[model samples]
Target: DRVRIFSRRLTDVTDSIPEMVDYAKTKVKASEFLIEGEVIALGEGGKPVPFQDLMRRFRRVHGVEDMVEKIPLRLYLFDVLQCDGKTLIDLPYTERWEILASLAPTESLAPRIMTRDPKVVNDFMQAALKEGHEGLMAKSLTSDYAPGARGKKWFKIKPSDRLDVVIVAADWGSGRRVGWLSNYHLAVRDDTTGEYLVVGKTFKGLTDAEFDMITKRLQELKIRESKWTVHVKPEIVVEVAHNEIQKSPRYKSGFALRFARIAKFRDDKTPEEADTIQRLRKLYEKQFENKGRLLKEVP
Candidate 1:
């Protein structure tokens, strides 16, 4: 069933250039179809531009025409939400994918491949990484499109360079951060023993507003407090970035992060969903293996 394809602009739902939306509308040969996809800004080298660069495009309202010329945007259509006057939300994703392929330009749509082989999947992941994609999303063919919902049926597999840890304790701020939590003690789960082991501490990469909000939230979950540190129940999950994992005798799991810093708060994730000590061990081992020898000296 073929119909006119018309894409509606969603400024609030996604951070995309308005010009890109207008361009999509112009490319629609059909007048009564709706497709869902991500809008990405492309660089001169035909690779994705940095996200901050795309944000710059979104903020410019006065000289949008010039900005659009400098930073081009592309849409990768993935699903069909509507066709003619009928809604396709109830249909399974595999069916909607077929409809999207039939209507959208082949060059504009993301490729869909079905496979169960892990080796093939690893090859695809490497290819996507080489092409500068964050990662690839794995979806169940039988799943339905759940709008505004995060479901386990979809998985995002990326490079194992980041870890999501939970905040177990925090220290009272001293200088500019006075009256707020300054240092956060992060922990990863020890699945075998069912315990959360403190790995490292960080107070970086958070805005003033985030510090204030987290202070209040942590206070709510606080169980014990001393003059400087307040021990709280594991509630807040945060993504942490580190140069490498090193052996540590100070903390459990016998590991620590080198130059650890807070990447972002994982509000969508819970403490139980945080990364595990086993995963950390695996990453540490992989790092050494990549270097062709084990790191005997720990930083």
Candidate 2:
């Protein structure tokens, strides 16, 4: 009877049906059902727009009719979770897809192709990239759909430039964040040495709630402390976005992250599985060494 969108939880975004929401609801032929998909704002040339453009409309708390017209929304639905009064939990993914395709019209389905050829896969990836999509999802046909769980059956193949590092320590903040663990000390794992080495620190890219949550978490994992800094067990892994990598003797890793900021806390990964320092070194060589030499030659 009601249309819903599920990310980690059932979202509260569904209230009265707006233009796009109504459109989505109409696409579902089932009286009672759930579908999983990505919501994207279509830009010029029918390319999926960047997140910044979508955020403008997403933040609307009132009077969204104008915004809906300004930035039209599209739901790229891929999976069905329920139909009528029955749950499709135990069904194989291929069967679920067949069910969804039968119920929903062509407009609600994600663009997909069936083939195992490497050349065909490459060509599809190129086309997706051309359309400004992040990447493609490759799901095993036989695997059962597991809600909110990351499994080996589905793979999101996207461009990777960010590095995952664990938080080693944090400084108790000042002013507005006075009691919170504000600045996070990030580290990368040394696989050969079996140690986590400090690479850099960042206080950027966290919400106030995130700061409060991390403070409580780090305090529980606290191992040692100084006047301003509290060292913790290498437990919290964070993905960091940086401008580039540079050599540094400031830490045992001999590499540092430049203009680093927190992308997000990687709750999905453990410290042991966090990215290695060797990867940072390789990235530095690949992205910077030639550019550095070229800069010197410019003089």
Candidate 3:
């Protein structure tokens, strides 16, 4: 039997995480299956590691065994699209999950509970959070599995926080935002050096009028321009909301925002008043207070 893994972008990632492939071959009971599962890096006491560790495994082309040993992965299967050459996507979630549970071990399946009580759901969310998980997913039992689409049937529960950050640059928008400068590069101030370091970028949560206004403002503040990006002075401040703060090697500050979006413009705040990298570092550290660390530092 042959098996393949894919990234969210649908790229073939079977080679990147050989342990997953190996697990499927040696551990999985089904001979022919197409499963939807998430591979999470595990740390001490079977706790999930940081997002960067999981990403590091995905990006590695060699020394995968060493990386796998350093940051062990656990696959939690949620949906079984196919099993034993039988299609399961059209089946209801309850049926499909039942079929999936039969094919995989309980340890390999995502922890789930069936309940309609609001208080039970809240308590489950709290349990998930206490275990260092971001949140829990709520899915309608009657709904069939749909690829790449999140409808009312499926909901993600999580907490979000906001911080004032400066826009250091922006990319030219396409489609609806045609001539407007969008896809803002978000950064935090370095209080000690008086410089701004990029943490992430996003073009979410903006109105047409706000887009027009910000485009004009960025154009006026533009210090330099490139083929796709316009570099600007980090003077403007905006409050951006994010689900999580992640350790990143791509940015100079070694931090990035996950699911970040502009909440509102902070005209009352200046660049100096914006959140600093030090503050971000503290927040990042605070995130894993209950969770076990996979590694002392990113490998």
Q: Clashes per prediction?
A: 4, 0, 0
Could you tell me every candidate's TM-score relative to the true structure? 0.55, 0.56, 0.91
Pairs of colliding residues, candidate 1: 4-30, 4-31, 4-32, 5-30
Residue range 1-299, candidate 1, lDDT tens digits: 22232223435522236554565567655568767777666664566644445556666656666666677776788877788788998898889888887787788888557899999999898786666565788888988878766398887776646799999999999899999997999899988887999988888889999999999999999999999999999989999987557667789668877667888889999788999998888886665332222112111
Q: Top lDDT: which candidate number?
A: 3
Off by over 4 Å in 2: 6-9, 162-299
Candidate 2 C-alpha lDDT tens digits along 1-299: 45554333554665322654676567677778777777777655555554545555555667677666666667777888888888996898889999999887887789998798989988998787767676789988888878777599889876546899999999999999898999999999898997999998999999999999999999999999999999999999998887656667798888778778998989999999999988877886764222322211110
lDDT of 3 by residue, 103-217 (tens): 8888999999899899999999889887877888899999998888968999999878899999999999999999989899999999899989999999999999999999999
Q: State which candidate has the highest TM-score.
A: 3
Evaluate all candidate structures by whole-model CA lDDT and list the values in order. Answer: 0.75, 0.77, 0.89
**Model with the higher TM-score, candidate 2 or 3:** 3
Error of 3 at 203 (Å): 0.8
RMSD for each of the candidates: 13.1, 12.7, 2.1
Model 3 / residue 149 / CA error / Å: 1.5
Model 2 clash pairs?
none
Residue 132 C-alpha lDDT in model 3: 72
